[model samples]
Target: MRTGKPSKTAIKVSSSIVTLGTTSYGQQILPDGLVDASEKILLASGVVSEKGVRWIKSPRMVSVYRAFDWLLPGQFEALGERKAFFERQVRAGIAAGATQILVLGAGFDTLGWRLATEFPKVKFFEIDHPVTANVKAKAVSKLGRRGNLYLIAEELGKRKLPDVLATHGSWNRESRSVILAEGLLMYLPAQAVRELFGQCLAIAGAESRVVFSYIPAGPDGRLDAGRWTGLMLWLQKVAGEPWLWSIEPQNIRSFLEGIGWKIAPELEGGTGRHSTEYFAVATNQA
Candidate 1:
């Protein structure tokens, strides 16, 4: 397993990898080390057993399992869906003769490496925390696979993403760029979410696309997100990431519109009809 001072929140979420391995689907999508790291974190945090084979199952657990089942082999079907969405945008950009991709909260995700291999002409920028980024960099380096990959380590909210892109000489206004922020928005406060979207807008033009996932606020616009919300709160408490923010699905659209973003239709998945996870594409129209 990779060695680093991962935050308690990160460690807790990593445990999901272990839980993922128990399912046949999770093993197919996530790398062995990532799975191991997640299991190890869960064990260290006392969220799972020492052997890392079993998980503290709950409604949330069952729902996650169902989601993985829906996506198949890759314990992260949501990721695959998001990847497909990004790929479509990329293909559109290619058709329009555009190049360049930015992935926020790159984490231990393998999309960049996979996309690089698939589209050698495209350049990828992966932004993440220093510790997490180092872990990913080392893993990819050991694999001996290269793809015009640049890793930038910085706190996602505190730093200026546009400035970072400019410093790297990768910022291009003419190119069609796609930004991915998967499994990230739910963890941030409402204000920070707006700020991050604002930064993305500054870097992107009218033609650029931003795809992200978020946990929708229930009818009340509060954290009482029903079955899944309870599970997340329990998981967060165990993972030491008690701070979570959620917004009503409708309010999210309004907020995006307020930010001058033109949103596409919301994509929903999961077993619970009410507990719909959303995938929205926002175009920087302004």
Candidate 2:
């Protein structure tokens, strides 16, 4: 019952980290064309240094990632809905003539690489840990893909995210780009989540758009007290990321609206296999 900060080792054992090893079902769910293209990009970058490859191939990382993958597919199927939602958002941004993208807690995500390739006119900033960012950078470099892909080496719930984004360049508010925080909100403390969102809102312009995913609070408004509570508990015990917060669907909508964001409910019903809870995308209205 004593909840404390996770150890360094525990942090390293994240479910997203396991996706790097190519063992998780994420690869299967992702479009084959995208997967192959991303791999090629990483190989050509020389940025996919030996260290990057080794980290992805580590047995321990692979095992943990796979475990999380197995326990959460039903949940994942819901989360996976975000992929299409993201695609649509990107297209909307492009059509609207936006030119910049900010992806928070990017994990080993290939969205930046893919979007950059597809939308040559847009710039992408992928914020993640230094080690992970470096690996991704190398891969992008090797792929010889051309786009403004900035890798910010910093922790998501730490001081470095804001600093890295500011150092990169100011957001082109005139055109209104998109900021994505996919599958990331459920892992942080409520205060941290609010702080991060505050920072994002501050930096984002009225024309800017933001999209993210969150776990809905159970009927009792307690974390992990739902049907999937047992599974979540097991995942936390093994993967080491406890459920910190769970907002009601309506509450999330209200929270975003209060922050001057125009909520676009992509995932409804709930965060379950048949539900759209996998992910949702929204934009800053003001």
Candidate 3:
């Protein structure tokens, strides 16, 4: 990430979130009202342009997404599925009496914002890179204060989650929590990813759930990218956020167990909506 500027990939993902929220296909996966709220945040932060919003809502946007889907092959829809999965796990956690909610690498996601309003008593937190968090914080400020929502700025890979979160008075390590790490693990080094899971377990109370997404390696133990692999990798490289790690589906169970988490059984054959990417829900309990 560049100094004084957010991650280019973060900005791009935010734009995609807006596009998914605005289109008819997107509404099927994500709630319309939440998508609208996210769009407002991106617009205020200047991550998305007004003209782009107009285009996404127009009929012509169908052609654009169709082309992207053809080229990217389920990449666009995967994001929507990830968001929806996160929201479901969070909601279930909240209903089961979890109080502290944490979103890692939140980018411009509006889950914290929307849920904070609905469940004002719950403490909601989003930890992101300083550059991206700062932009989103300023945009959220314009919308009005959400007293229950806290945005913390820190480079996730550089600091230990327990140490950084300890500085915040509102963060409670002893409380039951829902920890979210979406579109984040692949960006971190392998060691960092292991440490992250350990840190979350350390910070969480009994029965706490951790929801995350990961890319799965192919039969040859390499990135299982689509036909546009070169283009996709090049785009990420240009954005300064190249992929760094992947876990085979077979290894997920042992991997999570090593970090003291038990993988949940809700996933379809233990894979997420996309063939290349997968979302896992795990609990601190054995």
Candidate 4:
């Protein structure tokens, strides 16, 4: 990371590596999948030796978990809720007849690898910046063979996300699909987020679902109405990935409604230390 040309995607994906390690050591959330995913990350990053993999549980990971709580007050509970919501949406998508899933800004998430068997017929696509995507793909290829699972490496240039999707693989506008924007929306500007949704609308069928995570803030564009806002900002600066958008919780349903989506009542149910951040699952039913 130091010698090579610095990459923003690399920093973001590295954060994911830390998160996966934290999840692996803790008994609270997903351990097995993250542990498995961390192994892939380690291999991709060239720490293939057995002794190197054990570093996941070292003091560094412990520091990350501690920092996690400091960033969000009741972080463990909120994060656990986020995990449950994500899993629920996956099941819901399958039940609703979704045959494809496109994970936007996938970063180091391993859902495509972990949940492949559960929904054997569904095609899983993990999309990210080319730099990170290439790193992840190398590691994934080592994890046996996966045909239905595709790793899409591309840049989000000129708000042409849908075009990028079609170029990389199939973009079936008529088929039922779920587009996941986990841990991504907040990093984008308002216009960029709107553009992303616009493309989503173009290719998504009536039953298509969009499940995403967003941080909550009050009016005047403040984060958490000013609670831990400074700390969060500082952390983002240190990580070199500042969060750019903070959606008001009360206005979420109205916002998506304006964009042609029918908001699920339970979409805003989880995530947050005293409700500073939240996740929502929406779909257009036209």
Query: Which candidate leads the pack in TM-score?
Result: 3
lDDT tens string, model 3, 1-286?
Answer: 4557876766666567667766667878885476678778888887778987786556666567767785568777777777777888898899989999999999888889989999999999999999899999999999876999999999987888998889988988999999998888988889999999999998998989998888877777776566766687777677778888788878889999988999987632355547457888888875
- Candidate 1, overall lDDT? 0.62
Residue by residue across 1-286, what tens digits does model 2's lDDT show? 1223223222232223333426455555554454455444444434354566456556665565447654554443333345545655666766776688888767556678777777776888878666656665676666665647777767776684556566666445344667888767766888888777777766665667777767667667766434567776676667555667568766777776766666765422233323314355567664
**Candidate 2: lDDT of 142?**
63
Please identify model 2 stretches exceeding 4 Å from their true place. 1-32, 38-73, 160-162, 170-175, 224-226, 266-278
lDDT of 4 by residue, 132-162 (tens): 6776777777775477888887655453866
Better of 3 and 4 by TM-score: 3
Model 4, runs deviating above 4 Å: 1-28, 45-52, 157-159, 267-276
Best by lDDT: 3
lDDT (10s digit) by residue, model 1, range 11-43: 434555445555565556544344544443344
Off by over 4 Å in 3: 267-271
What does candidate 4 score in Cα RMSD to the true structure? 3.7
Clash count for each candidate, listed in order shown: 3, 14, 0, 0
Candidate 3 yields a Cα-based lDDT of 0.82
